[model samples]
Target: MAKLFTPYKLKNMELKNRVVMPPMCQYSVDTKDGMPNDWHQVHYISRAVGGTGLIIVEMTAVHPDGRITDQDTGIWDDRFIPAYRQMVDAVHSYGTKIGIQLGHAGRKAEDANPPVAPSAVRYDGEGYKEPRALTTAEVEEMIEAYAEGARRAVEAGFDTVEIHGAHGYLIHQFHSPLVNQREDEYGQDLPLFGERVVQAVRKVVPADMPVIMRVSAREYVDGGYDVDYITEVCRRYRDAGADIMHVSSGGEGPVGAGGMPVGPGYQVEMAAQLKRALDMPVIAVGILDEYEDAEQVLENDQADLVAIGRAMLRDPYWAVHAAKALQAEADVPVQYARGYRH
Candidate 1:
């Protein structure tokens, strides 16, 4: 009876509900081969059984050096495809659509021998190592790598693929002038890197397979870009073939007085802004945990979808719980029906 449980169609993938299980790294790849092992299969399949509509697997690396930790899943090689196929098949069996967040951690790649970024500056926090500036040639290669990873995702049977451009990763590094201090084309055109990556990814996947781009709508640090600039960048991404924008905030640098408020639906405004600017479906994420709060986001037209992160991590059955709390039809598994009987 709530919009949160309504079926929403994007491209060819139709979600059973608007509750999205945003990617949270499991860091359980014991082989370091970037393949999803039994842990990954169980982790994601459980969410499907728990009734999440769209489950985007953790930030999977496009290259080995792109991983934040060596344990992060990857699609950098064809060998990873079969493993992903197994998980995709398992998740889909529960009527849940699956996707993967393909990204390169860049300077944040703690496991890399010497991390790379658009510039040589190290991240400004503790435990961050200095990074080398990616050569012009390497930049081009990274784009191709993203395309290839996307290609692999399709082969692995994903309903969609998300480009992890948010949270100060490689794509975010290029979008934010605070980190992209180069003399070349990328520096002159900050959003060029993201646009190119989007275009590259679009070229590799099936035309019907939706491409979602996660973006930081506002940077918290001084001199960093704001919602206005990010809206423009998102426009470019939309033009470059992104179907949805996963709107988030901060992570470019340290927070300041102007940063986002610490409360529920804090970043919903950013998602609403992007939806208005780009005229595209947008996912709002950031502390939106409560069923009523999530419903309000949709009721107010703030976002097309609501991503539950920490809450979903705490309770895999978050969607089911929210459905019951809101008096909507809860998508409980038949095998568990006895537990829900009045």
Candidate 2:
């Protein structure tokens, strides 16, 4: 049997396989309320029925303006808990553990009247607003918001929680040299904000459940940090409380050759490097949709898990298909057993 179908565990969150459905925002919220609707339910629950080991819910906002667009989900208030509880319970019924990625969009918030970031540096992208810099006090408030979001997640019955510290969001802005030009604590210590977020999240979550943190190993933008630098930064986050590093790349600015390769497994080396450097389990993502390619990652010891994004969007039963192809135990629900029978 391939390791892709083998059960894996992290702290208290045990999985039926090594497949992970990384958070990809649906932007399907009908109202500006940040609640998960029927669209979210069918989208996620179908994947569970299809046999994904661990499903990380899309990057949900910790504050209102934290969302990239008004269509994204948010957990800034308690009223949102019941809706998430429904989603979480539905996903669990099929034996898949679910977690939510809590994040803040910072300067990239498309709907924010004027977004905020560590520095006044506007994303400078088309249609983006010039964001005001967050006050030091507001930054602290933001950290607490993350903690509160986790608290609500627990009440909603999430099996685990992920901190969205990658892809040039608020935590990323605080750490990226170009995005963060402040002279204060966060700037002086690039990983401080992320660490504080980890610590705060740890405070609310159960001591047994592992915390997953998604990080960009290297930036595609010129002058942005590299894998080597990000590894050290991640070391700080690990010490703070993050147990797994979901390694991805770029989003801070425009794409330029930052020396990272492109193509299948292009991001695996970065994940491998961080796994070696940080001594923490890592999830390798980007273009690893092919069954063999995804299996090769684990076989090669590059990453503890592989995330299938676009491919899974096309077919919810991607994990089941991979199992059949690999001749491993396919987690086909009994209702659909006839479809997968040889």
Candidate 1 lDDT over 264-337, as tens digits, reads 98899889989998899999999988889999999999899999999988899999999989999999999998
Candidate 1 residues lying further than 4 Å off, grouped into runs, are 257-260
lDDT of 2 by residue, 1-342 (tens): 899999899998999999999999999999888988999999999999999999999999999999999999999999999999999999999999999999999999999988999998889689998899888899999999999999999999999899998999999888898888888888898889999999999999999989999999888888888888898889999999999999999888888764546788888999999999888899999998899999999999999999999899999999999999998989899999998656
TM-score of every model versus the real structure: 0.98, 0.98
Clashes by residue pair, model 1: none
Q: What is the C-alpha RMSD of each candidate to the true structure, in Å?
A: 1.0, 1.0
lDDT of each: 0.93, 0.93
State the weakest 10-residue window (summed lDDT) of model 1.
252-261
